[model samples]
Target: MTIRVADELLMFLPAARRGPVSRVPSDGTSTLGHLVESLGVPLPEAGPMTLGGEPADPSTRPDPGAEVRVASVPRPQPVPLEPGQVAPRFVLDVHLGTLARRMRLLGLDTAYHNDMDDPALVVQANEERRVLLTQDRGLLRRRALWFGAYVRGSRPDDQLRDVLDRFAPVLRPWTRCTACNGELVPVDKQEIERDLEAGTRRSYDVYGRCADCGQVYWRGAHGGHLEKIVHEATRQVEAAGVAK
Candidate 1:
């Protein structure tokens, strides 16, 4: 059987196997999903697929010599949800600490631990109904994962953009604590004055405190840069919503 993966997905394949088309030696019973994964593309990152020019799913077993075409996941991809869930929540692998903080800065619910093992991460995701985001292809292939996505970039900024482009979660800037993924609540300046430095007291009046960890936040020198990121993410999400 022959499989033709979309250009966007070709990066996942071995250099020798990458091209417009590929030949698969199917035993005539393997499902399309298994075949595609064997080629190194995770199912979550794969978009629409067709077998023999007709629509097909991962479970569809292709006959020998059949042609299968796999596309990359579309922008603003819909996140699968369980009942009662209002929005997509995410849990990240250890290496994604910076991305996790950035997501929190945008007020997205993100859970991350630098020391958690793969099993623990999967458990947290399933128990909390969060989509697992990781750069490790092997982690995404774990059978126990409820939902998973392969993070595409090596740099934090590029990785953040890739995530926003793929799943346009609502951006609520400054509403979450970047340090703890806690909700931020407005607090009187005087209430946290003791925690603030002398310059902070004089420079700004607005303040927010993390409800979970007591971390204080204000429009510090880095606020402008953070604001830029939020603005760009907001625009990206709005555009994605409109595209839908």
Candidate 2:
């Protein structure tokens, strides 16, 4: 029996499943879908599979000289934010440290650590029901992962845009601790006045305290900068919708 597999699909499959040329399969019979999945590529990774130009389910068996075509997965469609839909949360790999920070600044629930091992990151993502965001292909290959995305861009800004576009989660500004990803609670100006700098005390009145880390936040120079970035990102998202 001879079976044909696409080059991209070959990279994720086990060595035993591939052949020296375009067609290989000396013995045994298996469904094309099962064989592709056995190689570590998820069904979603290979959008639709066809056997001999006919739409075939992954469960369909392959015969000798079967021409199997596995198409690459399409980019995720942007889902409109619904009033009751919960915001998407993320657990980023160590390589995406900057992206995690940006997400936090935007009040997105993002978990990150510069020193966490791969296994620990995966565990945290699963335990917290947070989407796994990574540049590593191996981590995305994990079967236990339910919601994961491969960051296609290299720069932090580009990566952030990629995430926002891909998931289309609701945006809530100034609600999270940028350093620790904890919820921010409103605090009276008098309560945190002593902790503020002399200049900050004279200029800013509004403040929020991080429930977990106890860090104080106010609309200082840094806060203004962060707000500007958030505003710009929001505008871009809105403009994209209008253009469509």
Please identify model 1 stretches exceeding 4 Å from their true place.
82-86
Clashing pairs in 1: none
Displacement of residue 111 (Cα, Å) in model 2 is 1.5
| Per-residue lDDT of model 1, residues 182-219, tens digit only | 99999999888988889889999999999999999999
Question: Which candidate wins on lDDT?
Answer: 1
For candidate 1, the clash count comes to 0
Quote model 2's TM-score: 0.75
C-alpha TM-scores of all predictions? 0.96, 0.75
| lDDT (Cα, tens digit) per residue for candidate 2, span 1-244 | 3334556456555677554234545234677766666556655456677878898887788887677777655434432333665676789998998888888877788999999988888889878778888887777767677667777688988998887766655577788998899999999989888878899989988889999999998887786678777997677666655655
151: Cα error in model 1, Å: 1.3
* Model 2 global lDDT (CA atoms, 0 to 1): 0.74
Q: Which RMSD does model 2 reach against the true structure?
A: 4.8
lDDT to native, each model? 0.92, 0.74
